[model samples]
Target chain A: MFRNIFVLFAASLFCFASCKKTTPLEFQPGDKGELEVEFDNVIGGVNLQLNTGSYTNASGETFKVSLLNYYISNIKLQNADGTTYTVPRDSSYFLIKEENPSQLITLRDIPAGNYTGISFVLGVDSLKSTAPVAERTGALDPAAAGAGMYWSWNSGYIFLKMEGPSDVATSGDKKFRYHIGGFGGFSTPMFNNIKQISLTAPGTSMAEVRKGKAEAPHIHIMADASKVMNGPMNISIATNTTVMVSPFSVNIANNYVSMFSIDHIHND
Target chain B: MINKKKSIRARLGITIAVIVALVSLGVACTKTSRQERKPMPLVLPSNFPAPIYNLSSNPITVEGFELGRKLFYDTKLSRDGTISCGSCHIQGSAFTHHGHDVSHGIEDRLGVRNSPPIMNLAWSQFFFWDGGVFNLDLQPIAPIENPVEMDEHIPNVIEKLKSDAQYPGLFYKAFGEGDITSSKMLMALSQFMLQCVSAESKYDKVVRKEGAVFSAEEQLGFDVFKAKCASCHSSDLFTDNKFHNNGLVPSMVNDSGRYRITLDPKDFYLFKTPSLRNIMKTAPYMHDGRFLNIDAVLDHYDHGVQVNSTLDTSLNKNGVVGIKLTVADRANLKAFLNTLTDDSFIRNPQLAEQ
Candidate 1:
């Protein structure tokens, strides 16, 4: 009877050790990790080369991009288990330039989990856009980070700027310029072109963010430049050479709203 | 050995005394400089309403105001170093471009709108004719970057200041020792602008019961103004700070005034109701400077009002397009308007570029 009891005790101890080893460690309440989102600018599946790459839009007008810059702000990550993690407002604004060496946005101190989707605003929010000059720093500084991207006359940020030469453009220099921005209005209501973008990672590519990992998960996103002129409303360069601070800019904003998509995710 | 030790001790004592004297001298210099930078008081006029600008964010100081005055007069703010803010906003003309219908800027480039005065701006809620710029801090950027105005980028202006021999030191004295940011520069400009209080006018004295009573003609004009014009120009500041359509025939540009900012059809042909504080000095009048004098403006109100969909109801009362002012009423109104000029404000040497 004693031998049988000892044997049962040893068997129970083995089972406990094996069970602990097999189950994955669940993230604790205060556990945190990092995430990176890369915005890859492309024109119809071809990498965008500034000032040299020639591309034709749906209107059959060929154009060469000289400058492209846009604001991405208010980032929020959707956890796989129905929870959302919002980046702090102060550190959320970012300026994505096509000529910049890095378009990767790294979010630190994110709650460690399996993120299934990401969402962000394509332009500065109306509140921050109208914030006091002291409150506007970093990416929103009208003179520094937002020099060319700001409209000093209108007192708002240019949300997206795309300027280049188009053969069919009607302008004297044959340049198609689209400087789109409007945060409603300060005293009265006007054009609000702030677009919200939400992209979900494709099948089998969930961004797994775990603590103590050697590398953080990277969400690769493709921002198609062709969609700016071709999606929803087909913007012909010959017809609309310069669209800025007008009712027509709303259509351009609407087209660019559908420009982003999740290409893949790497959880290395 | 005793004599050598005494000599060494004597030398050490002398060295310590010299160091103490130098340190005190340095402290004295810094103290005087700091005293010179003492914050200037923004004295609010007894007759004026509470200032619309929040002074706590950017406090006024003697150093800051002086720096701003220098920047206001500095030609480096323009593209070709020819036009300063004072070029268009002349102090003798009550900080307006006197006589000119539309102020000319760098390279003799003409702007679309008239150059407004720079008095009592702390009481103003909006900056430009269309009220596009809401904050005073953001107002300078428009003219500094306007193609027909200064035609220079703010960043480039800052760089020029940085490379200057005196501006960097002046900026340091005004806003501590740091990089001269655009925010600091704008705040300094606002400090000077806020100090431009125009409350010493004859109208203000009469209202304040300061013993300076208005003449009989001025009193009659004041009564007429109260009856006909006080609805729009409705405050101690002589402006309700609201947009309205005064029914002037739209210019050839058909400038859709406030509509450009709001993009609302109801706001078409609407412009800010300008303050009447320096009306006697700040002419040609109206947004485009169409009226050459107060009489022309009165004539426009009396018989020259054009009918428009967005015309102010006060101007078009029951299909009557104009205010129907008699010749005598017009003379008295002009007298009352002249009482709004604050002579001391225009001549304040502190506001002039040194």
Candidate 2:
């Protein structure tokens, strides 16, 4: 009789255990680490000093970057052991600008291990890009990011906004604004733009990305602005000066895809 | 007389019961602590279709609607603080600019087209005479940026709203954020516009069998309307929500209408079919407000249709031009159209500036 009660109690406990929600895999206390991701904007392998006029592109059109900002999201760190740790979506995305290069974008609570490579998506994912304005919070929030990056006419974030004055511009103001955003569709050119970049650590078999260490590893990424309009797909500021939203904008977006490159990593 | 085993079983059962109670209590506490907003239901007449605007994304609340109403009336939205949305859309004239054929903006800047009435907008999938904006949340950007209208940038508007003493608190109450945004501001405006439904007309009561009847001439006019006008202006909302040329002539101006958006030659001269519900009050009709009254509008349909490559086939009556109507038919049609004016909607105290 006692055995019967014990078996029933065990069965109830089993049911309770099975019914509990399965928690997502995340960094344990021992595995917690921090990474400082840096974006260095440049022009022709030189530091891009904003508001400094007269930088010539491959097309020979001289221009100055008045404003430059882009979104980076969906970061993943691949370990040497063939396992990958993805940053949580709620806090992974970041909007970087040339003006605030000092504002370090740090990823905390990353799984600590020897990482072979780092991978991330250049633009905001379609799920987030197409989400209604009210759902956006934190870094993705329109108010937080500033309204300049968003096109109030179209319901999508400008994945990349590079505005400046170009000498070749025929317009009265001699200004050129390249606002690129649209996902991949025949009609909707700005919907499915997911540019995945994977880069391996150099000068070592694998970089030791450790947790609870006094010093965290840093990843420096360089974004070349001159390559944006002149990279394999050559765009002229004289003709295609302004691109807001159209199939033409997609051409500019395709060219900028080749702009990001892993510069170097700093080990402490 | 009971065995010791029975007491042990009772205790075990009580312990299990306590655990279950504790688990449920934890869940209840978490749910309450989150303070999930209770959905504010949008009540509509039984006959109306589901709203095109996705209410789930930006749900309406009492505070949001009130904020929108305040913003709609405030001239601070304009660059010069002289023109408000209410300036062009007066509630007395079914929310349309009554005297102006075409709307005038800031600094007495005249717009190219007339301002349409603002009602039954929840059902509409597109907005503006050219159907430029699809989402209601994004519609306000057009007038705000149109150099002739508000002449204000969105960022400038946000900065202005931030500095205002009362707007920050109002925004906090409506959106749970002390910080103001263009999206939140636009969403609040959309909330107020979504509630402007007109359904209490005398014609509506007659249709619902509520002991009301149309006059003999009005009934005749309604029948004539069923045969002649119901194709484009269908449904109780009185709009097909599709673009049509409608044979508006002297098509000299470079207003390519729907063609401007699509860049298709076939879509040229196509304009959105406006709702004829409040036809009597919102006058100087047509996309350009060329017609002064219903008589001029009917006369255009009768004899003034200019044959164009992009003219809608529905208006083509055996290639003879407009819908041929007799003098009596026009009179009866005018009388029937009058019955559609809902005083309850035009004079709704809820929509008035508070």
Candidate 3:
């Protein structure tokens, strides 16, 4: 019985794949352009490089970025005609790690059109993040994803993970690690940690690519690392060093969410 | 006026016909839905509440469940390949460590608390004594990673499984891929655990109107239980699935129970009310397994309740501490609790190692 079911499932999958191949691609009479989303980590206008080993926060606490990674998803580009083109769900969510060679996120297959603004979710939505482990694939798969971002103790994907040694040390361990991500586990609304941010392009018309062409202008997004510890809540390393999923983690998450804004969009 | 009355009668007749048709259609649809889904082998007693487990996420397959059963008995999951899940949870004793007040793990390392029996886990929303782990799929992690328990890291276990010749094939058969994952392993274990339904007791037979009658003493005991214990141990499942401070004082061990998880003073000494399905067979009751048998448990309820701020308000009757029960009442209650023992469940060969 098991063998029969397996055979049928395999056959169905094959049929589905073949059907997709037979189907024609739906493309408008316009060039398919690529949008590059870049992240510039800085500290008070000074460029903040990862693993450089020393940087000070607004609270006079010096720290280093041993690891920094987060999820950016649900990207949408607004056209000049007020119409929006959304990035497909299957390949939308991107895991941005500082150590990765490609700091610039290249979103392909975007139809050539006059775009004004771009908006995206800073973290994976609850619907996908909270889905059963079996359903997830590729980058979203918890086991294959981040080294320390996924909580082994529970069913949750840590949205923002930052770990490094800090000067503020009251205990034996001087390392500061913040794993922030929680949605719908607690009754409080503040515990729902997914953040949504929008950035309006500085230019009136963001891009205009020629027909049958690729590679469009880049959207430069400068994310300041200093704001993470020194935003609305002045998080001191001596007291509040690490948070997994607590009220303090929520405050830290808020700071990280506010750190991103489109510096400028290059159309040239 | 006569024409208007006739028209109204016709409309009523049409409405009744439509309602009948809709009802029949709905029944037919339900029947087909049941057929399509292939009624779960895991028997969900008609009287029990809808299972908390989201079945659609990881539907139980015969091959998968069998694989899980094999893994449950296999000691490869442990550090030295000595202690398996079955080591603590023996089948004849309702899947609990019989005679042991507290559970010991790999290398005879003692754990802090008693190992609770595994039965009807489909209905359990929260797991463990403290109710710290909410998801059932994640519950195994607590035992697997506990230094005193299996003492095996997840990655190490996966590596071991990959090396094993049999496990790779089993994984492929169960999940359609040889790639063994922590998710798949956990889900397969859940599938096996979910099928451990213990509703074939004499009490269930009586409740099901199967011509089985309860003894007079049992009937009386049940009435007493309804009046006193039914609030926390509610319905056929015999659990309200809520945490309560039943006045078990925090010992020198400082086992604060639920408060350790929630970090709230109100939740101090609170523990998830365990289901009393096979309460008679599974001796050494309570989270710490302090009480030896039913008599000690009843005695505690009657007089030994420690008065504290977090004491369950229901147990406090008219400002009097503990429950008021006579010796006769205790005996009768014990008789009724014994009727909950399902002989068929404990002796089931399918659940045991082949």
The top-ranked prediction according to TM-score is 1
lDDT of 2 by residue, A1-268 (tens): 9998787777657544643442212222367778887878888768898888468876777889998888888989877668998999888888888888463578888776656577888767778765666667666765346456665544556778898998788778988988876545212132344577787766553444566767777777788888778876788899888987656776777777878766777657
- TM-score, first chain, each model: 0.90, 0.82, 0.82
Point out where model 1 deviates above 4 Å: A1-33, A208-216, B1-37
Q: How accurate is candidate 1 locally (lDDT)?
A: 0.89
Candidate 2 accuracy as TM-score: 0.79
Per-residue C-alpha lDDT of model 3 across residues B143-260, encoded as one tens digit per residue: 8777899988766787888899898877766677348887888888988888888999999999998878999999998999998899999989999988998888777687888765
Candidate 3: CAPRI quality band: incorrect
Question: Could you report the DockQ of all the candidates, in the order they appear?
Answer: 0.59, 0.16, 0.14
| Tens digit of per-residue lDDT, candidate 3, span A168-204 | 8554677888888876553113366788878777645
Cα lDDT of model 1 by residue, A11-64, tens digit: 656544544423223455578888999999999979999999999999888999
Q: What is the Cα-based lDDT of residue B32 in candidate 2?
A: 46
Candidate 3: stretches off by over 4 Å: A1-34, A40-52, A99-111, A114-116, A152-154, A186-190, A202-217, A263-268, B1-40, B78-83, B99-113, B130-134, B145-156, B251-268
B72-191 in candidate 1: lDDT tens per residue? 899999999999999999998899999998889989999989999898888888988999888888898899989899999988999999999999888878887579988888888888
TM-score of chain A of 2: 0.82
Q: TM-score of the B chain in model 1?
A: 0.91
Q: After superposition, how far is residue B273 of candidate 1 from its true place, in Å?
A: 0.9
Candidate 3: Cα lDDT at B322: 91
